[model samples]
Target: MSIDSQKGAGLPAQGTPPVVPPSAPHSAVEKQVARSYNSAVANETLEDYSLRYAPKSFRRWSEYTVATTALGGIAYLADFAIGASIAISHGFENALASVLVAALVIFLTGIPISYYSARYNIDMDLLTRAAGFGYLGSTLTSIVYASFTFIFFALEGSIMAQAFHLGFGLPLWIGYAVASLIVIPIVIFGMTAMAKLQVWTQPVWLTLMFAPFVFVAIKDPHSYAAFTHWSGGTDVKGGSTFSAVGFGAGMGVALSLIAQIGEQVDYLRFMPDKTAANAKKWWTAVLAAGPGWVVLGAFKQIGGAFLAFLIVASAGTVVADEPIEQFRHGLGVYITAGTLGVAVFFVVLSQIKINVVNAYSGSLSWSNFFSRLLHYHPGRVVWIFFNIGIALTLMEANVFSFLNTVLGFYSNVAIAWIGAIVADLVINKPLGLSPSIVEFKRAHLYNFNPVGFVSMLIGSAVSIVAFEWGFGHGTFGTYAQAFSPFIALALAFVLSPVFAVLTKGKYYIAREDTLPEPLTVDGQLSGVSMECGVCTDHFERPDMAYCPFHSSAICSLCCSLDKACHDMCKKGGASSGPVDLTLTRASS
Candidate 1:
């Protein structure tokens, strides 16, 4: 046998997995689970990188490439529709105020979250595991993030369907499937395919995206007057003037995209290793791609409002908010031949670009979610089909018509989730209530951490109750509905710090990060290559974990699926222990 063959053939992958004694025999079930993990990784390429940290080698894309690709995901026309919906319901003053406030909040929260995810080379799900959620705790976040994707996917797909219906004379049902199915092939290759598509189509998309608005702005001044004065005839509801209540409600709808930062980080993680020489380029790309998405989204929404107003007389309130209809009318001023056809082309192009991202991010989210719950492994490709299927169903059910209602409810929970994360990163860790470094490995974390999980649960529940049931009678109930998300955000921010102080950061870290030298060629460990002792498979270090049951390093998927060994490695199994300052924090 070769020297490499003998390297880890019989010996354990070595840091003596803290689990059962080294001499304990491996169970048949343990062996089976390990084999399954190896298979899962082998089949999951389109995910770009999943289940663990993206390695340096895989970080081959330039900063510009990753940033632009992430930005491309924001090219969806839903923002336009959302903007139009709010303006028509709330009037110009409230809608404008809503967009600015929501954009500011989303941007602020995005800064730290984006920087850390990119610096650590982890996606939001993995980052959540360390930030505060802990092992099984992040499962809730995974589901919430997944819901955002499919909901947005369905909304975007609906827009595409409408375009097809108007242009090609296709049925909405077939258009829904067509819009949903076309994205599958693009996303199956993960970031690799997504980057190419976004970059190639960007110039054309930008020209088409901005051209209609510029033309309308240049040629039609009366449209602006109508937008400022119109309120979709909601005068009795106080829609003609600025209402604090209306602004808050509209803001809730816009902030629902706070979860979109997760999709951005998914691509930013692939940004090439930051070097001193490229420092300027690195930070620029990270900032632009990360939370910077809403900057573009906010303006596009304003444009959507303007265009919707331009067509409200002809299209009416029911159809005015549709991007297909808005753009068709906007383009009518400029084009004489195939006017509807040209408008449909731009709308279809926009939806395809954005839905691919929705589909891709949803797959990543579901992969993280089910892997933690089932302990059984299926590749991410399976989840892509699963994610798209859910969105397609929503499209068939006509989810787009109830846009504001769906998004308003969803934003409250999403705000809570994002708020807790931000609090942990900005406040808790800085105040010395928690560990500064993020410890994501399962063996090194508790199953739940109240700093984020408990806070999130309470915040989401309170906001939901307020959003649905009246907080008080008459005027107060209106305030409660509009300000629902602020309640979630404020409570999460306060509760996270409170929980950290109460718990004394005891649940933050389990055991220290101790990697086996045998699995790494160098003294230090990395995500490059490490051999799993049970399957004796060469796997990435990010996928490998120190397991005492087998007295070796096992891949995460195997460790999750293993039915035995029972987490004995961390001194107290299942139950968490306080952090030991003596153990020393790991440096990134």
Candidate 2:
């Protein structure tokens, strides 16, 4: 298909159109202005289309490459810490069962979320906008996702700081600053730099990560048996056996990592469009790197538990949960000389690998959140510092000391948000309660959609109550308090479909896709390029949407940033009042 050579018919020529005298009222073109960004934001390489759809032209990575990068980001050591913490609080059996259960839930829910993101080449924020949350409704989800990034960033940064303190005599505060500041230069380049960094470092990182585990198995095979018997010297309520309360509380801590799938999808959004020729490789990549991250993560958590068991027998519970201390003892099994140095190296490498993703994905999340709320986007690069600064503050506050408390409390809200989106993608779409396709462009979405927005709010509210206060009393309250994450998940999942039916799915699309060119041609996204009426820049067909104010096609970013239009296109459907969305309960 040919690129549209002309600007919008409604827009005049490139130079200022000759109209009335200079003192006259501003021309129509002047009234059609939008907040613009610098070249840094406009350049796709640096920005990576943070707040807009990633076009087909830019998705050039091979399936293996994309999958490898996505999986590489999962090389964090937090799973070990989380597992160790859970095991210290609850015994081996409960921790094991909880981690496994949480892994299964995350894997199952992540399948639909990752598939839709890879298929549509949009980030989780954009996907949320169309899946069930409407345009503005997704801003809340963007904040949720952004919080996940910085929270993990602080956690990972803390781990790295611990390495600095152990390997060198650096103060913990100085180390925190060092760890937080280093990733800025790397993350500023976005995917172009990350793709290379993740790929090049994968082999060495993998070898370092597994070396201690393999050596431990070889040197002391009986340690595995001993771990199942050791209990971190705690009275573990059930005493190494599984208890319902222990299992539920442990699951809540483990499920906090559900938001990790969002970071994975942040990379999966770059996957090349699948075709018959690449079908095998594409599916393999998606399944392996998308939801398949949990497989490796589960092992890491279990491995962390074993390592903690080895150390806590002598090091005490406080030292056992720290990744640096856990690894030092585990790797000391064979590397008798300079064990601290070796372990510190591994910890630092692991932290860098994961924190880069944390910072990068956080920038995207912040960019998405602020753009809609403030209608001002300096650039994706600017937000990298904002995300890291928050993380550094949390790190200085010693966030890692209370890791389980933070993660466990956070799981309720995170699970609810992810659960609502998963339901829309997997259940509602299949049952015809929601649209089959993802319509993410701003021009085509309502301000809010109850199908996802209300479901998530109710789920979060109920689960948070369960988490804080429990149900009524007795055994039921104990279970409810412990399993609040699951409560959020179940409520959101069921209610998404219920709300979709009640709302009649009208809010999913605010206006029909009346653009001249079809989104897809011959079963694939059309490669046709169109000029944005506002920005006057060209974007692929998927990123372009018709603007009634412009009377021509405009790019999604321009539509998102335009404060002047006030959604004149959507307003036409409703005469005097707000758009008649059941989500808002407003009518003309």
Q: Which candidate is the best by TM-score?
A: 2
Global Cα lDDT for candidate 1:
0.80
Give all TM-scores, in the order shown: 0.90, 0.92
Candidate 1: residue 60 Cα off by (Å)? 1.0
Estimate, for each residue in 285-399, the C-alpha lDDT of model 2 and write its tens digit: 9989999999999999988888888777678888788999988988889888999988998899898889999999999999888888877889999999999999999999999
Query: What local distance difference test score does each model get?
Result: 0.80, 0.84
TM-score of 2: 0.92
Q: List residue ranges in candidate 1 displaced over 4 A.
A: 1-23, 27-40, 233-239, 516-528, 539-543, 571-588
Encode model 1's per-residue lDDT on 1-588: one tens digit a residue: 221222222111223333435443454445455453344357546546677678765777888999999999999999999999998888788888999999999999999999878876889998898777888999999999999999999999999999999999999999999999988888888888888999999999999888887777778866666667666433322335788988998999999989999999988878776667888999999999998999999998888888877777667789989999988888877777888988998998899899989988898889888877886557778888999999999999999989999999999999999999999999987786777666677776778988899999999889988898848679888788789899999999899989988887777776654563322233222545666666565656555567666656666666665555556766653222222212211222
Off by over 4 Å in 2: 1-27, 31-36, 234-239, 572-588
Looking at model 2, residue 464 earns an lDDT score of 90
